[model samples]
Target: MKYQIRHRTHYRYTQPLRSAVQTLCLTPRHTDTQHVHHWQLQSPTPLQPQTDAWGNHSHVLAVGAGARMLQCEATGMVETLGTPLQSDPLGPDPRLYLMPSALARADDALRRSALAAVRGVEGRQAQALALTALVAECVRYQPGRTNANTTAAEAWLGGVGVCQDQAHVLVAACRAVGLPARYVSGYFHARGGPELASHAWAQVCLDPAERRWLGLDVTHGCVVDERHVQIAVGPDYAACAPVRGVRSGGGGEQLTVSVEIIPQD
Candidate 1:
């Protein structure tokens, strides 16, 4: 499947001041499952592409003073291939993902949740599917109830959150069950109703020997497919956020993000 993607992020400040420096993880990586044909990032500030420790392509954007509003847009064409039922993990040691992060920490309740998920599951793949289902069942999808910093345990306790929280919860639960899982940020084309084009999911290592990674979407209760365009992978959302930064003087910031993904003929 091929897709054309456009994403625009805009920010407004109450008080304008000097410079701002931001890290951008908006560029998609070419992998076994996906290939980037043409991609470009547009912003008022100059963008210098750099690869992070995790092999994600990042852009450092530096904006000089005097602009009250900043806009960043990314447009691209990508071809996504279906993962064969078997494949090797492409990056660093899988154990790196087993470690808990600030937002993906597992608690006693999360441990219990993990225990319940794999109670009768016979194989690792079955256990992973069960765990993903358990997370979806435990946390109802509700937006505006939590913020970006909300942890997996906190969202589980509330029983409501967005895709980001769902991915976090799934990551934490998988780790609790001795599975190495990491967070994935990407773009998804929604058919109808209400759905954010920008999406988040989890990839769990099912077979370290074969280096198999299984992509799971607890938010929509489905396995990630060609419809999903991979952007970045990390311990949690914070690491793969599309844009993050600090400014010398930008008071009371308001941000808006709009994303669209269309299939190509």
Candidate 2:
């Protein structure tokens, strides 16, 4: 299937910004599940872009005019394809090793929630997958219910969040239980079921015990397959944002955003 995507993000500040810096992880990477045929980004400001350590395309955009909006508009054409056995999964294993920054964020609630998910599982590996399902059952997928700072324990407590929040909760839960997990920002193809939305999910590595990486969307209650299109993997959302920035020269500014994802027939 082919898709055309249009995304616009705008920012308005109370005061004019002399300069602005931003990181953009909006480009999709071709994987076992998807391919990017064409993509482009139009920024109101010029940028210095680089790929982050976590594999996200990063950017630093500067603002010269102090009174206009800061915006990013992008369009792309992509194809969702099938996975092949010869292809390897992206990122590191979770069951093997997880860093302190990643694991330290877990609280009692996160641990308990994740543990509860695996309590009924028969196998360790399958336990992780079950945990994913538990999270989906626990939280409602409603965008604008939470923000980036909203943690796993918070979302678990609230029982709702968007894809990013869902991934955060699951990542925190997985890491708290000694699983090596990372955050993933990407696109998903829903086919005839639903329209596409900018999506976020989680991945775990099995380390030496099992040489495999698994992708899970707690919000969707399923493992990522050919319909999934991944863009970045990191310890958190800060590592893989479609567009992030601050402006100093703009004041009393109004902002609007629109994101559309549709399947091409």
- What lDDT does each candidate get? 0.87, 0.70
Best by TM-score: 1
TM-score of 2: 0.83
lDDT of 2 by residue, 152-224 (tens): 7778888998888888877777777667777888777776776665788887664434445678877667777
Clash totals, every prediction? 1, 12
**List of clashing residue pairs for candidate 1:** 89-211
Model 1 C-alpha lDDT per residue in residues 1-265, reported as the tens digit of each score: 8988899999999988588999999999777788899999999967898988666899999888888988999999998886623243456787888899999999999989798879878987889899899899989999999999999999999999999999999999999988999899998775554545689999988887777788898887888777778899889999989999889887888989998888885
Q: Tell me the spans in candidate 1 whose CA falls farther than 4 Å from its real position.
A: 84-90, 192-195
